[model samples]
Target: MQFQTFSSPHTDRPNSVDKVMLQVILALLPGVLAMTWYFGPGVLINIVIATLSAVAFEALVLKLRKRPVMPTLHDLSAVVTAILFAIAVPPLLPWWLTVIGMAFAIIMVKQLYGGLGYNPFNPAMAAYVLLLISWPIPMTSWLPPAVLSTNPLDFMQIVSAIFTGSPPTGLEWDAITMATPLDGMRTNLDQGQMISEISQSPVWGDFGGLGWEWVGNWFLMGGLWLIYKRTITWHIPLAFFAGLTGLAMITFLFDPESYPFALFHVFSGGAILGAFFIATDPVTACTTRKGQLIYGVAIGMLVYIIRTWGGYPDAVAFAVLLLNMAAPTIDYYTRPQVFGHGDNHG
Candidate 1:
């Protein structure tokens, strides 16, 4: 006698890797366009350069490892990684620096860990952290929004700055670049200034920094669209914002002078971008539904804690990396039992 046998049930998802990556690229358009409008064309330049560099590096690595090259590049994961990494860095980051970061992300961080689904951490965040640590000065030199910029460089000037590290003939670096809102806030608070007084600066907008909040809003919009399209689930993002805003609200209620309001925290820096894009990375994030909440909330809480008390003013990259290390453990504990094989919580 023979018994018919089949493997466990597995749903055939219609979403392919390339399709998902394409959707993500489309989702980023609104935020990217907003950033270009506010800041300048430097961001678009970075994206172009980083994308080319990332694909080249990815191909190089695959060739070294005797893997099929076109098949991997066709998936568009490398382009996504490059774009995410590009947006995280200063829009005017030097071209060589951008290339270096992409190489590190694609080769050392991604491929070294067995690539894509096998990677334990988000390559873009990891690359951002590395660049920030390695080039503190260049990494922090963010351009003020066009409205605030006293000397806005034209396209040629911006390109010259990235490639040659020189401003226009009449403009100095200080005239073109300014500290980010989060960076400015940390500096002022360290000098014992209250939040109320600090918020009086010209950089302050309704809830976040001038121009910066609008960019955040666009990213939030794009993220919601992704959720609506079912490109990504909402579990991670909802829990992440809940954790971040909950902490901010509590602290601000106690001492509004010391802490910025909860809404400010949500819109000020990388909070929205990290919540929707960085933390939602399927490969590095938790797999099980229950585990995703724990992973995201933990990252959100860590981001607030580090930004508030730790040395860094913006802690998204650090927080994401820390939680990436914990995701596997979270998934292991949260794994569900089979319908017929019941289990109880320990």
Candidate 2:
């Protein structure tokens, strides 16, 4: 009797692309809910627009490329990318801009580079950067947290704002929109305001901004769950925190009056989200175990450096994209040794 030959180890892997994507989606729900609570129904509306547009764009591209459509859509990667992009932008961002972002993310960043696994840059982040640079006004027009807003947007008002780029009948845009915590901090510090004075503002919370720190806490919970589920390793997240806090502490120690506390950096902006989700993109991030640590730390350090001195107030997307470019080189230098193979094998 003869048996057919097969390649390598025959054990089944625990995770599939669809499963992994589903888990990520699930992990993000808590953070999404927190955002919705703090920001309003606009958050949910953004997610809806992004998801539909992303699915449409991906299907259209696949059809044009003569590739299998349903199978790829079933993978849920597009949905994940959409959710990420949606959450990163202003909830009241115009609907057309959202569609444009999805178009660029799916067609240019993802499919054009050969779908999913082949893309060099994270599609969501690339699209986010594109929108941010191209449309700074709309991109930065964030709604104040519900507690802080003079006029919190209702569902219909939010829908109208997103679709028509106008506030409700009586409310002005100035009444609803405000700078984010990071942006506020950057602007105040530039104006020679002390951290203690800035922290006294009602917008300020225990660590970060009001509502914003709670959002970070929820994201941290979700991230810890992802780690517990074995969906991601702890190396990148841990190293990311180390690198970010390390730099932040140095600056804060030099002159606490001039710099925000380290925990402020940890809780404000997209630190938690980037550490867990964006930087941990398995395809674009480092593959080697040691490489991941370096990749994460570099991203973290870049985030601190950019937020402190660079033009932008938040730098997660920029940092992640920068490290995506370096991931291959990091993997090359950090490659593990093979068992029974010596350095002089050649």
Candidate 3:
């Protein structure tokens, strides 16, 4: 009798690329809704604009490469990348820049190296960094949450602003735009303001910023859901939070007036989102369990260091990209011993 031979690592897994991407989209919805509530319809508009442009750019690239377009498009990887980039940028970022970002994300960062699973870096983050460095003003111009906005734009006004690069008839960009929580903290800290005094501002919350911490909470819930669903493991997120808060605690204890509380770091600017969503990108992240912990911790530490000292306010994109370059080396050293290959086992 003849029997079929299989590969060394074999299992019957039901998950597919499309299915995984779908779950990620579902996981992001709660956080997206919260952002919309606090920031207005611009969040949704960004998603729509990003989605359309990413699909188009990806299809164009695939056609140029003579690959099957529909199958790749069906996987929804482009859409996921698009959504991430959209949410990371200013809500009222001009439409053309969004298109440019998607083009770079899909074509240069994703497809140029190889598609999807083959790429070593996170496409969304690479594109985000590119846009940020290329156009600092628009990229950093975030708006005050609805509760604090002097004149919040309605749906029509938002659409106009995104397309036209101008707010409503009377309002200037300064009237609607304000620095992000992380930006505000960095700016105030640099100008000789105490953490306690900064926290007294209306935008400040119990931990982070008023609307920002809640957004982080929603993303945290979504991330936990992803873990429960087996869409992601807990190693990265846990290690990330541990590393970030651990460092924050050390500095905060030394000088309470200078450093914000540990939880402030946890609840601020992309920390929660980066921990679960971006850092956990299977393709770009370390695969071995031990490697993942190391990768997560390193990223967390880098984020704190860069945000505290570097020019950028939020350091998620920078930290993740930096570690992406190191993930292969991490995996190499952390690879587990084979069942029958180790000297002791033999």
Candidate 4:
């Protein structure tokens, strides 16, 4: 007969920060690969540069703060931020901009706020907003999808473009780049063009745009997988889509020529990604179940309002950051009362 032996305190747990972040990285794969297939190797290059720089910056910040750098870097939260910021930027973004974004994300938005769980806002989105505001031209210069592009650059050319701002000898900047689907739609609509006329453009697809809609689909699949795995609940994403499509439908029904359909709004921009990834951030998002819905709904409504009328083409980053500021208030009001206390007797 052997006596059972258990560790002190006798507790067992199955999840960790590293594990959750790793799962998120896995969930991001389908979308990342779709971007690569549609855009080119610059996507991967940006990820690499951002990830490496994020680790380096995090380590530097930790060392300056006299903390154990290896342990902090091992958790891989910085890597997640890096990857998110990478995908958010233009594929052909310069190397320095990539470095600056990662550094700002890790050093300013993350580590300086006591690292990881203590940050009040999503680090990646903050960094993206900074870059977008500071370098509007480079940030907005998105390459046309491979299908739309007449001359897609090879890997070496992409590297060269990132480092040197030089396209291949035969091609110039104007020839290789085109507006993203969302940006193009906004531009056309503002120029007195109707949705019907714009839909006939070469960029149009069944839902959003030729290659872009497929990428959004893959991201949706990945988000569903995260929900299935219990990494994230469905409340935020569901509320987000509901709020977005609800408004889009209302507007479209009121004036079909002025507003696009709801599904097109769902599939066109960063709506799905923001709903699933950015808005659901554990550190910055609302924790209470009811509060999460409110948070998500606010983000959704702001997204539609901003993209429709605001100067920016994509408003996901801005919306998430704004709601991040409001999450604490939402949580405070929605916090459940303690059982057997506060007049609710046991």
Winner on lDDT between 2 and 3 is 2
Per-residue lDDT of candidate 2, residues 1-346 (tens digit): 4444486666555438999999999999999999999998888888999999999999999999999999999999999999999999998999999999999999999999999899999999999999999999999989988888877667888899999988889888777899999999999999999999999999999999999999999999999999999999999999999999999999999999888889999999999999999999999999999999999999999999999999988999999999999999999999998888977866
Off by over 4 Å in 2: 1-9, 13-15
What TM value does model 2 have? 0.96
Model 3: residue 24 alpha-carbon error in angstroms: 0.5
lDDT of 3 by residue, 204-251 (tens): 989998898899999999999999999999999999988898898999
Q: How far is 326's C-alpha from truth in model 2 (Å)?
A: 0.5
Q: Tens digits of per-residue lDDT for model 4 on 56-104? A: 9998998999999887888889999989999988899999999999988
Scored against the true structure, residue 210 in model 4 reaches a CA lDDT of 87
- Runs of candidate 1 with Cα error greater than 4 angstroms are 1-15, 343-346
- Give the TM-score comparing model 1 with the true structure, all chains together: 0.95
**Per-residue lDDT over 1-346 for candidate 1, one digit per residue giving the tens place of the 0 to 100 score:** 4444466545544539999999999999999999999989999999999999999999999999999999899999999999898888888899999999999999999999988899888999888899899899999999999889888789999999999977779888788899998899889888999999999999899988999999999999999999999988999999999889989989999999989998888888899999998999999999899999998899889989998999878899999999999999999999998787666645
Each prediction's TM-score versus the true structure: 0.95, 0.96, 0.96, 0.95
> In each prediction, how many residue pairs overlap at the backbone (N, C-alpha, C within less than 3 A)?
0, 0, 0, 0
TM-score of 4: 0.95
Candidate 1 local lDDT, residue 244: 90
Candidate 3: RMSD to truth: 2.5
